[model samples]
Target: MSVAVIGMIAGMALGFAGYFGGFGAFLLVAALGAVGFVVGRFLEGDLDPGEFFRPRDDRRR
Candidate 1:
């Protein structure tokens, strides 16, 4: 499926969770999804942990 479709599904799931389980559930699901994505990228050798914490030149004044 396309990214938009996948995002729409995820958004619907999260909306239901928030409606039935409250704000905490929504936050928990979002955080878990983020962590899972990072882990998957790491496992696939596409993520560099060090780069995440390093300062970027674009951020400097």
Candidate 2:
């Protein structure tokens, strides 16, 4: 879902910059969605969102 949103946004940006029509934007979004999903799955092991934004938990009992 997130990937789809990102692709759509990116496609729109590209369309605006390069004057691509609706069909071009849709194609760009589809291509990006395919590539992004494949790459994300391959690199999933190397990513951790919590480590980037969440604070560490320290507790002693």
Candidate 3:
């Protein structure tokens, strides 16, 4: 699925695990997921739009 959905699921899993086992593991995984989401979004924004749609070379009126 989408990166956001994956991030939420991972965060929930880590949060629950932390609740049951320890705090450090949970924080670590949750932080990782959050950072992944942020970085993924940032990189996605930098992609070339031409990859999605062909460029229009015509410039005449």
Best by lDDT: 1
Which tens-of-lDDT digit does each residue in 1-61 have in candidate 1? 8989978988998898899999999999888888987898999999998888888764766
Model 2 Cα lDDT, one tens digit per residue, 3-32: 688768876666664565566766776677
lDDT of 3: 0.74
TM-score of 2: 0.39
Q: Which stretches of candidate 1 lie over 4 Å from their true place?
A: 58-61
Distance from true location, Cα of 42 in model 3, Å: 0.9
Cα RMSD (angstroms) for every candidate in the order listed: 3.2, 9.7, 9.0
Query: Which 10 successive residues of model 2 have the least lDDT summed?
Result: 52-61
Q: Tens digit of lDDT per residue, candidate 3, span 16-48?
A: 879886988777877877787567766889655
- Please give the CA lDDT of all the candidate structures: 0.88, 0.66, 0.74
Residue 54 Cα positional deviation in candidate 3, in Å, after optimal superposition? 32
